[model samples]
Target: MTKDFKVIDEYYEAGRKALKSYVTGFVLAIFLTLVPYFMVVNHALTAQNLVWAVVLLGVLQFLVQVVFFLHLSRNSRSHWNIIVFIFTVLIVAILVAGSLWIMYHLNYNTMSDSPFNTNEGYIPQ
Candidate 1:
């Protein structure tokens, strides 16, 4: 085949692969979203189990977006890209977890039911 034809064929193949990846990602993302939504709406799982299930599905959706949408393949050329992505994820996780921890502590400490709350709903007339 001519050089021009070869380049065109490669471009066509890449486009096909990208379209497939996007469709698959979209389907998986929808399934993940619907599963959690239904689980919550139908009370399919207990509260603790529901929370875990939703979290697991959310993580799966995140991974699907990363792999299919971001196209972060494990090719040698993209090694640095993968490393940078991992670092970003780690930093985000750390920030989220730390913030949640701080918020939980703050809420627990200041809640009306806490032992530190001495007023006990007493009112002065």
Candidate 2:
């Protein structure tokens, strides 16, 4: 029947689209991974800049996986998926920032340069 043929065609098209999306995601993921790896192996960037670059690439790779593999998007009918992702990102960011802040303060306060800071008084003036 013509109706059955139409349904089959739609399925075929969907399959092709999904495959293309997966391939594109794979290429992007490879690129993101290699760039950071080379940067580290070659010492192409300073420690701070390399860290930021790697982090940025990691985020991009994550996004590619989410969109292509997980099929999460604003246009999707399940709005909750995107919402949940946003919430997760927010929670993670808060945790990381809070932890870093605590660690920095702890290190700063513990390494006091006061007069009693271990053998300073005994050293030759």
Among all candidates shown, the one with the greatest lDDT: 1
Instruction: Judge candidate 2 at residue 110 and give its lDDT.
Output: 66
The window of 10 residues in a row where model 1 has the poorest summed lDDT is 116-125
- Those runs of model 1 whose alpha carbons end farther than 4 Å from true positions after fitting are 103-125
Identify the runs in model 2 with alpha carbons over 4 angstroms from their true place.
Answer: 112-125
Clashing pairs in 1: none
Question: Quick one: best TM-score, which candidate?
Answer: 2
lDDT of 2 by residue, 35-90 (tens): 99999999999999999999999999999999888888626686987888899999
* Tens digits of per-residue lDDT for model 1, 1-125: 69999999999999998999999999999999999999999999999999999999999999999889988983588899999989998999999999988866665555454456455343222
TM-score of 2: 0.81
**What local distance difference test score does each model get?**
0.85, 0.83
